[model samples]
Target: MTKITIPLDNPTLDDVARHADVSPATVSRFMNNPSIVSERSKRKIEESIRELSYVPHAAARTLASKKSRMIGVVVPSLDDALFGHFLELFHSHISTEGYTTVVASSGYSSDEEHIQITQMVSHGVDALLLVGLARDESVYSLLNKKKIPYAITWATDDLGEHSCVGFSNHDAAVKITEYLMDLGHRQFAMISGTLKGNDRASNRLQGVRDALARRELSLPDELVIEGPIGIEHGQKAFKLLMSRSPRPTVIVCGADPLAYGAIFESKVLGVEVPQDVSITGFDDTWLAAHLTPSLTTLRTPQQQMSLLSAEYLIAKLKGEDVDVPPTLGVDLVVRESCSSPA
Candidate 1:
């Protein structure tokens, strides 16, 4: 059994052309614009690419065509499966149109996000997909100055002067809270993601507050727990809320992971879900439906948002007259985890 080994140095376009028995110019044309290449040449080049495992130098291609054929995406964190799903959909949609995605995480910091954005731009990303429209003013300015076609995801703020492909976090939260209120839940507590630099988290918190205010209820300082990302943080926050003298009959988590943790912690504390307390979460992730008591959550249109954002950016890159991307909506998924408070 003989093993085929590729050269230590990368295979170049010239090598692919040689293997394909075509001129280097023909090979370049086939790569840059395959539609212009003849069928026979296309087949040959593709076969050569597969046989040699030839990878194009993005930098060289960008220099020749003035198009990087790359899209940059910066999200707050990748720990959430929701973000992973979004990336998967976004990547799949754009890949069909000859674009690749590069992703970076900001750890939920605006400054860090700014740096990542700058780095992506410097590396010659054709466009950017940002999580939200709450970054530093300079970041926006930088995009404008560079004339980069970028879109915001996970939030739809039409008031902002940018293209966005997401739903209103505030409205989704309101829907969840209102539903709980309708279920006769008055004593409410919240386990929220850190709102310091996250507009999504801040908006969600405000949504809960606004809904409570409309019902002549209030979210007391003690009932609100600002938590970091993860199940452990959710567990700790739940414990703190449950420790209150008059424990909340209902707990609203900013995301599903927190709600999952809360449910687990409830069992540990000998509290029955929906009997002693009702719990609700945002982002109807895959796990939400399979929990012991299926979680009541907001079903965000993550796939739709990602697909539209990718398409919008690609269209804009092609000098198309792209309109402001439509704001997708969320659905309220009522499940076993939430019920009338006892």
Candidate 2:
């Protein structure tokens, strides 16, 4: 028998059927169970399949069986050690349940997160865990449509409809700032992660603003600088804030890295921490206590959030009814970094 020539390099089922001179159903039947098809048809179908290289999706069955056993996670960033520690506990929990994690860092872009999550779903993730609840609505819609179990993390208020497990950024910030206010600190400067596309940062910033407003003290627009949550950025922000006419008496950082930078820069600038300017951080990462003056920051329940989120998703995957956990709160840990103005 002569082989058929096809222009299309990546042919579909129809191409195989046409080349074989059989219906698409016949091709499917032959591929699924070659013994059921007549010898004549099988010969032609085999030849057509080889010539056209028509690839039938093999993963379709895996998706139907839900055997991928992979959980997808997308975080705002991986640069923060907080996420690293979070993932460590999260992966440990899920892995023990016979699931592995596939993590993606969106670099705090909502659009990128949507695209990455959609790709993960298309790739047949059994479940998902996302950071914050600030992405496109389509992301949630797609998860629902696909019936994929997911948990929205990093926020205390589940916002009524979307039940989640996380600490309140707003409340945590308020706690730290109020403590500072109680120490008679009035001048406030904040070094924050960019508020754009990041609901946590936005909420924390609002918390500071709210606390300042209540105290009859307002942070100048210039005193607050938003950038990445890295030490260098923190140092730059500290330098800039210190250069202002009336330097900040206290600096509130959105993350521990920023607070670390403020303290480091304080040393370099011949300024004393707590004595010259008080500092505080959020997401009390492990390094917070190791700093020279130590760090006063709000402790995020990373390990608890990770384990609970893992259990929540695993229960959903197993078809077990889960009690949606209430919103978690943060604790303000007083350390050497903060003191009243001298």
Candidate 3:
């Protein structure tokens, strides 16, 4: 007797269709939305699939029906607290709508984002959610070629080419700056993430510029330090700022991470927050509230934004016209870290 090996190729939809004596289209329809299929046929197809333990190919079904019920979300960094919040909320919302989410990290690199987008499309994602609009041309070209439903989050534009669901970083930052300015903060220093590839950071920097411009004050190159949104970066930037001839009385951080870094550095340098030097951060993360001196920052709807973005994209995927605006709004949260300039 000869022993034969059975390959684990996984049973496809064709096996279910054959067992049920129905066409592949019917099986596909039943899998995507069983409500559309007749009760008897659905039962038969499902039973057959269970008997064979069939697992359908995502790509084949998508090619046939032009849908995958899987939404892809691409973000800059997954290690950050904000992005982690985004992933959690997005997953919750997507699951509620009978859809799934696939997340990919771009690591703050356009090339990396492009590669991730390509891989996502190949995996048969019904739609895509990008962190910001700043990406390589190849990304847009691929989206166009595949006609994928995509939405830009964390940033927005006036144009209605695609759906956008987030607040304007420029406006939010300007509001925060204006609030600080009203407290008599004249000299300013900014510890910002690299603005070259990140639209959110760039827009925030522009808002800072616009805010200063209104007061007839200008931000010089010396006052701005561009680096990673890390504690180490913030510490180095703060040290460099302190070395200036006339140091800034207030420091504005691009994100909460940077703000925390600045605060840590200030403490290490024998400076008291809000007493020796006022500090403000963007993205009112939970850590911001839990810090020794709670960070004064803009309250962005990170979780809500994630849910709304997923809802809008899923609606678009289902051929429903969603009336989501281009930009969501943000609020300002004043906390212990910010006060009248010393």
- For candidate 1, report its TM-score: 0.92
Which lDDT tens digits does candidate 1 get at residues 76-154?
A: 9898788998999999888766788999999898889988999999998889999977777898899989999999888
Per-residue lDDT of model 3, residues 213-287, tens digit only? 999987788899998888899899988888887878888999988899988898889888998788889888888
Rank candidates by TM-score, best first.
Answer: 1, 3, 2
**lDDT for each candidate structure:** 0.88, 0.86, 0.84
Score every model by TM-score: 0.92, 0.81, 0.84
Residue 149's lDDT within candidate 2 is 88
lDDT of 3 at 286: 80
User: Number of the top candidate by TM-score?
Assistant: 1
Regions more than 4 Å wrong, model 1: 1-30, 33-44
For model 1, the local distance difference test gives 0.88
Backbone clash tally for model 1?
A: 0
Candidate 1: residue 35 lDDT (0-100): 57
